[model samples]
Target chain A: MRAAGKRFAGGRSHGDSRVDQFIEQIITGLSIGSILLLVAMGLSIIYGSMGIINLAHGEFVMLGAYTAWLLQSHFGLGLLASLVPIFIVVAAVGWIIERYVLSLLNNRPLDTILATWGVGIMLQQSVRLMVGSELRYVQMPPSLSDSTDVLGFSVSSYRVFLFFVAIALFAVTWLLMNRTTVGMKLRAIMQDRSVAASFGINAKRVYALTFAYGAGLAGLAGALVSPLKSVSPDMGTGYVVDAFMVVVLGGVQSLAGTVASAFFLGELSGAIAFLQNDTVAKAIVLLAIVVLIRFRPEGLFATRVRT
Target chain B: MSISRRTLMRNAAALGAFAGTGFPHIWIKNADLARAAAGEIKVGVLFSLTGTTAIIEESLNKATILAIEEINAAGGIKGSKIVPIVEDPASDPATFSEKARKLVVGDKCVSVFGSYTSASRKAVLPVFERQNNLYWYPTLYEGRECSKNVVYTGAVPNQQQDEFVPWLIKKFGKKFYLIGSNYIYPKEENNYCKKLLAKYGGEVVAEEYVPLGHSEFSSVINKIRSTQPNVIFSTVVGDSVVALHRQYRAAGLDPEKMPMASLTTSENEVAAMGGEAAAGHFTSAPYFQVHKSPENEKFVAAYRKRWGADKVTHFVSEACYFQTYLFKQAVEKLAASDITPPNIRDAVKGQETVAPQGRVRIEPENLHTWLWPKIAQAKSNGQFEILVEAKEWLKPLPYAAYPGQVCTEKGLVEKS
Candidate 1:
């Protein structure tokens, strides 16, 4: 408690400094939440439809980062321009894995976990062997490189852009799931595969497409994050753990729940970090989440679906 | 294009080998091993080549290999070529210990050179002690401990902070903001800074720690902004180094006005962060590639020639290069082919060498090298400009609490 108060009590007026630190923590929370939204959305979608726990989804993020690195290094493409290509490239790889390898272990949840874990290892090592294991850098866009002062506090424009990007991506995904034929088929298949097949919905095709789309979303997340963090082969491992928490705590099948959870976890962790040390903050967050899960085992807003 | 070029080089090497006896690459590897078994002395090269510290450790690996090549070309030590068996510890402490065991007990390496982080060094120390093997650690670290089985070729806490703190206090104001990644190195380093600040009539305004790989620095930046400290001393390593620097710049803080000082940011980090972000920051290190010495010039030329011109060298890598030469000098002092641990350790005591870092003499008392402390400023071109350098070698005091160690422009000596 003393450590927390000590940090906030600076050279500035005590109340003013505390207020500023709080506002800054909120912004940091939002920045973390946006990244979590992008990552966990894809993870939740895959888990909702396929019932497959993708341990390798984080590796997909690593792949997307590498794809962006290669494009920028080889063709002088900026971070924004490399996003679509990275999505396509990573989606195609995900599609191949789902069609040939994952299709074999569809109903076996335990096997899929081990298989994906193995795939993650393979992906990490392959990148290490090919790219030579060094931290690669992706330059931020020149336009968003500077900060914009808001109420006398300096705020990064890139972070503001990221928040907007997360909202836009979420809106697009929601529309795709609610207003389109693919969305209806995916929902039907998620609810009942046999019923969807009886209604002439191609469950197989939808499964592969949804998996690829999820992978693409992960790639997009990776591309967006590349400029902020150092891009390394093991970069995804940490994010995947955090994203899983976001998806689980948000209620795995509910997008709104995930969004809420992402913000909640981000803010809580950031605010706690502001007060306590980082390691203790992490412990408290995980402990709180664990207690939350004990009370609501299906998550905060999970729908009742009879399987 | 780089991958293809590497493939082409590999193919050409393969073709040249095949042209002689039509042997496969596997057989060629075996033949090299056979040669090593017959005449070469085996030395283990260990470094974190794949995980978080890979960026820095990979350069150290190349530096060690370059030294081996140079030594071999210079007609080998006592007519025996050195065979380096390289292994990647993958930046795990347990893996480091396991590999150290394998190198000593299994590979029969006479000496092992590696490790960047103090955690890894600590992990492998007991193994080296148990096996009666020598481990030459070549990274500047938060020092307080000395292992008889290990030879430290990098700057200790006193050697680094002694030069950095006073100069920083004089150049900047007296208030310091200390921040670091939550680990042994950073924790220890910040503690050292706290003590140094107190000694120099300076004070730490605030102290903060973030987890390793914690990319977000906005909260910490806000604190730094409000605290308005005169100097920001950072020991955040890996990706966090990039994040902190970027966020500090993005938060509208002028580097020239209230500059950041780091013990960890070398040329490797500066290049990764790009030159602009690191432009006005200060770094305390013993070696910089920009040093205009004949030894450094030759080292840079040979390294560029071997590893390509685009590749950059840093303090740790240069220290590793010097470590290998120092090892060779120690080995040369011994008679016959008795490369036993005790014999080598005894020979390395009080040994001196004119390395690329000027002059390094291993203190017999603590088994740590005496090095010249240098403070450099980062330039926009991803290089360092030496602001101040010690006039002479600073004697090794592994424990910072040790008093009566004195340094002058001419040399360093300790009072009995």
Candidate 2:
């Protein structure tokens, strides 16, 4: 009887270890999913408020990186300090692009996509021509570079900080969208442009603000990621494709859906990558997503219809 | 205000007669000669200026421009000015074929120097063959392809893997792990290495191929650690190389303990990987920045003067520059009435020159150059310090040194 009891105890411990590993993997997945969420939020906001896909959205992120690089290279600012000015500068550029180029094609989404694609090409080539196409490094703040022991796992402080930052940004974005008058106006414009104009909401002004805000978010994401990844002309290409996938997999107009889908895909990809080759893992994830879309039509977290 | 056709013709005739009479005879004669030579000596430069490989292409273009400028300053090739026409392949194979046709049929270039990817090279091969124009490909690629119309100036497997594998075995003894980006170059090269490793009594621990441009590599690194092989034979390229090396370091695997001997990691990739990340890694190539020679010194100095001091990569852009010189030397050797395509091809195959490396000869059978291979270790500053060199130039054997099944399946050989 004592031997059987000891055997039961051993089995319980093994089960506990498996549960702990599963939790750890979930945490890692959520951390990565948060980063993807931040990037996709920027993309979704721009696409939602203004019909422009902004193919140069990724380059705006690149600009943010370069801005941070320039700040450190020139002014000797720390990572956090440099991020502030990068946000401002990149936001200003976004405003200018919106006011000058994107506004010209208000109802023309296809033309806007093409124009922004051209803009992306020009931006990448200009960076290459000016900086000579070499990878530049951004200094990680020493505090964040170190790791902290959490539940017997060595989790990077930088990664934890990134999670908190993303959550904070998400909360702020939610407040801005739900509570503010500008947010209401922007949402109204998105729902029905003609009706919003009838209700005396300056759709143009709302678009400019939304564009700037979207770009600012992208800038922030770029500043956050520069430390993790090297800065180059082509640094953002990989993320752009994944961001598109996230936005589509989620509904194009649903922010909550975007977050949930990003997390879902991120966890799916991360877990599969752990088991199989990354390529095969991605293929499986994509296939699963396609199957889900065929069955569900909306998404995993489609909003309930009030009707 | 409307003039009749007869009146317009008469006025035009009078003006033409007056201008013809007033123009200098020397000027007129020079204009006529220029018109006669308007069919210029055309050379095409196909490079990826817009896509993922643009970084390498930019350096290659700068090197090519430097070569063209120097050649033009020396009164041009064969007394006719070398006209360079450039096209961007955008790193797309289909686009490469289209651009190659544009260069051959539309621009009518005599020879093309380009292609950084094996896919792009394969796409343009039929175009070059059909047009019967010369292509001086300047990037190290999969080594099974040999053609009369293509002068592959880059390193072959024998020049790189044959020497590197044997030397690594001598230093680190018979255990290996192969890691590479999932592409033709890595797949083909790793397969060849497997054959060679087996022949040499070496055991290949594990072979893992990740997708191209894959960023996250913890699992791959974990596999490497679990396998615990003596050395990693790597063929990853571009941004993935950066991610792999950085993750490898973060995972606490010291290259000093278990070194990675890579085929594709050059000084440029080292720079991308950062100095700290790339330090102590070993890479094998036919060229290095720290190669000791007066000619190399001169070439380095001139290159620095032309394109700032900070730009340096140890692959074969300098060799591309040397290829232009080789082409010029061949043209000078022929000294034909007109520098036509057939004559230029014959001249290139027959002529020999003392290159920056040493005396190089183009094998008439395959149209590839025979040159020495240099092994280099990645230094702290993203440059290579030459470690060992084949003192004599190894002949370009596009086929395996020994006749075997692998070589035969690929249809690569020197036909006597």
Candidate 3:
């Protein structure tokens, strides 16, 4: 019994102050919000340009996590080394899904939603059948495994890394959508597909690329978050719900809106959870989203368009 | 009732198949009954082969199969092979009861083994009771009731926390922060923990719950950090265990300083969260894979050989494996021809066996097993190092938390 206490370090408290607690909670919430943004950014992009609700977006994230786990576990690839490979692999999967399965359901919005959902379940079940339903873990990058002191409060350096990644992804996405030639073509298609097609934009190719990019972003989110959570076949569902919440609460087609709402909801839930508890926090946050949705059906940051 | 020619011919083929098993030509009225005596003894193996709980339950299913396979290889309880009719309840309570009904009524299994979650057990309870069939439940759970129709092979809260809490308080300090998945097992176990804590004059800094499958823990970790309790009494179950442990590590909260004393984390869970993720954390259970004994060594070796080298056997799977041997031992007492549910149930009442954990026996008084209690610190290799173990088997007390309630051989006995 005494031997059990061999590893027992003497106690020392950190971040006991109320101000410190507040600051820590804010950072924690931002970290969570950043994850939501990462997952939702691709969803918003796909929806904004294609008007295709890729319900399999979450599965893309799950696949990315699985890819990271696979690469690291089989090939001895570190988490950092596997990120590009994970993104590419998952994005390729997303590309095939879009070109082969989703493209057939194009004109039918309801069918596209249902088909993508079917694709999601198929992806989940295939993973379950192939890998088994056991929880899989991804190795954390050794460099960022420890906590860093911030404003006298300790915060996970990995989470801080994820936040920066989310910001960087958002910037890249912003540049791609606003400045790139692909962005011009995608915008033309979003505005009027026939006109874009008539203007030789090759609307279908552009749509597929946008879809693939969105999926790549979601996959990256999954890879980054994998170290913090267990990777399982159904891990995507928990994240997808929050991602949808972020996308819906943000204007459906707005990347900036997704970033704003993800943090807003995250901080709201985080602060509430600190004040009360998780159950109450979730209930209140969901209630707030519902009430907000009733007043503004187009969402908080609906893009103003002159018709 | 008149038998059609088609049914008669099918019965003839089945009878012929049974005859090939080398049994003497006994006058049997029903072909199905002869199938039990001469050919096979069918039992139900109900488990969640798919769904949320599959991560843990799948191993339990494998353990059950491994035990059954071993039994069959050793001539199978007086020459009749034990055939398992396995079904996946998919971790749903309604499906558990539904499949339990089908396994008992439709498949005509002599006895059934299943259920992990308390909700599924409760759901499955009524079907077994109504059918008067035996159900073997092999998962540690919150104890509050004793049913005549079921045999419990896992530890209850009393068997788990009775020794654990005091040891934690003595080793650490009085202040404990309680957290768990929002479910009955955790809630009930925490009730027992609180009761014990209060009796021991320990202080509860805070208590909280996360929803099932909830993976985020930064907020909860923040609370733990601010409170700075000597111990975190965690009952958090399922995949969320991995998340909580990983996040706890990432948050720079040293388990060595304020260790998570878990009632739910076992070797299988530790396997999911790498050893480093929860290295210094503690778990209180009736069994761990690293339990040393000839019986345990053989069981672990055989289990790994049958499954994979990397596959782990935890408290639940150990119970699941030994309980099958218990079932076989009970079934062997009665003649193969007379192996009915009631007979099996009666025979299983006082059965004792050497489990991977150690020597264990079912308490005839309550139908719950007498189990060894141990606290273990997780090693970085995903194996647990035993810290403290009870000198002898702890008695099962399903209704101990409730003063007026007690479970006897007959059933629940209440006092005003």
Candidate 4:
């Protein structure tokens, strides 16, 4: 025991004031919000376009994390380098699922929900069987692993990277949905599937592609967040609930609304955690969500659009 | 029931096939009983193979399998083979009870060995009692539980914190902070810690709990920094253990200044967090994979050989292994050849075994084990260097007395 004491340097408390701690919590909230934004963006697109909630969206995120883990371990790729493969692989899985199982059940809302839930379980169990149920770690790249002192607030460089990555993914997704002809077709289908089909929009193909793209975005979210936390099959379970909350609260039809709600919820929960305990913070957040939804059933920014 | 001519002819063909394959004549004779005989006994091995708790419970499952294999290889118990009927509870408490019931009722297992989380244990308690079956739980848990149908092979709070808290107070001062996952185990354990601290004239600076799997620890970490407690007594379980340790270190809080000690963190968690991440952290348990002893050495060698070189076993797994041998020894010692729930339960009372950790004895009174408590400091290699160990096995207590007798003695405590 004495020998062990020698190995440890005596603990000296860091000079962190209350104001600094508050700033740190804000940053933590923003980082968490960014993750929520990335995950919710995909959910918003899928729900808005198809009027079908993909409950297996979280499993897609789980797949992305596993893809990153596999690439990093097998190919010796950095966490950043593994992101592209993760997105592609997860998107491909999403495409196959959409083409096969989901396509047959299109327009059957209740069936879609239950089927996707089953799909989610299958995916989670499949991953657990493949990887073995143990927490796997991914290292933050050495350059991004250290903390950077910004305005007397010690900010983790990895979180800073995650914030920017979330933005970049959001921006790319925004451009893809707003500027592309495919985006136009998806929006057209969202408004009226029969009208869009009559107009030669190929609604089936558009819906499939849109769902796949949403899944890929979720995958991207998973890959980015994998380094900051332990990777496991069930890791996506927590994120999915948060993602759904963000999408619903933000207005499923509005991407900007989704972004806004994600940040709001994330920072709200984080800030509350600083003031109170985690359980209390979580309870208050849930209560707040319920009250808000009660008043604004169409969500904060829902247009009078059908979706 | 009338036997069909086709069924009789098929049975005859199967028997002829078995005879042609050179199966023993005894097997043919016992075909009507479906191979049930005095030479075979079935024990259920229940564990969470999937879900949240699988990280720890899976290790226990593997260890249980290894123990069964070892016992079977050692000429069986009085020439009677121990057949393990395995079931996956999937980490749900209700599922634990359901699967345990299935193991007993459906598979007809004489005894069941499993349950990592206390919730699961409690869930299956009624099932075991109803079925009149024995369930050997193999994990250190919050005390205040004792049952006739259950044999606890792991240390309770008394056996562990009795030695651990005093060591922390003696080495590090009385100012302590507490944190844990919001659950019965951590809540009860911390409640015990608080009483012990009060008795020892120590101050608890702060106590906090995060919901299970709440990965955001930045706020809590900030609280610990401001408080500057001498030690952070932690019972954070599951994946969050990795997050808290990583985030704590990442926040530049030196473990040397105020290290977090936990009853929950084990070798498996240390391995998950990486050696350097949780380095300087302390854990109190009856067993660590790196323990040095002839029994441990042989156990580790065999475990690694059977599992993998990369796989690491912790206290939970070790306790499960010990329970298997204890059951084997008890059953062999029984005058009767049949291994029933009542016979095994009675046989296990006061049964002693030189387990891998040390000599562990099951108390006839509470059904908990007399375990040797040890405190270990984690090294950067994901292995714990044993810092201190009990001079003798601490007696098991279902509801521990504050500042138990063994903890009152100082000379018996070793520094290194």
iRMS (Å) per candidate? 9.4, 11.5, 11.6, 11.3
Q: Which residue runs of candidate 4 sit more than 4 Å off their true CA positions?
A: A1-18, A304-307, B1-36, B401-416
Off by over 4 Å in 2: A1-28, A48-52, A74-78, A107-115, A129-134, A139-161, A179-181, A184-202, A304-307, B1-40, B169-175, B350-354, B405-416
Give lDDT tens digits, candidate 3, residues B85-109: 8999989898898788878877778
Q: State how far residue A50 of model 2 sits from its true place (Å).
A: 5.0
Better of 1 and 2 by TM-score: 1
lDDT tens digits, residue span B231-347, model 2: 899998877888777656644467887888998887777766667778888998877877777877777787889998877745768668778888777767654444655566778
Window of ten residues with lowest summed lDDT in model 2 chain B = B27-36
Which scores greater on TM-score, model 2 or model 4?
A: 4
| DockQ, ranked from best to worst | 3, 1, 4, 2
Model 4 clash pairs are: A1-B416, A10-B257, A11-B256, A11-B257
Number of the predicted model whose lDDT against the real structure is largest: 3
TM-score, prediction 3:
0.93
lDDT of 3 at B30: 38
TM-score rank order: 3, 1, 4, 2
lDDT of 4 at A86: 83
In CAPRI terms, model 3 is classed as acceptable
List the candidates' TM-scores in order. 0.90, 0.84, 0.93, 0.88
- Candidate 3 lDDT (Cα, 0 to 1): 0.86
Candidate 1, pairs of clashing residues: none
Give the chain B TM-score achieved by candidate 4.
Answer: 0.87
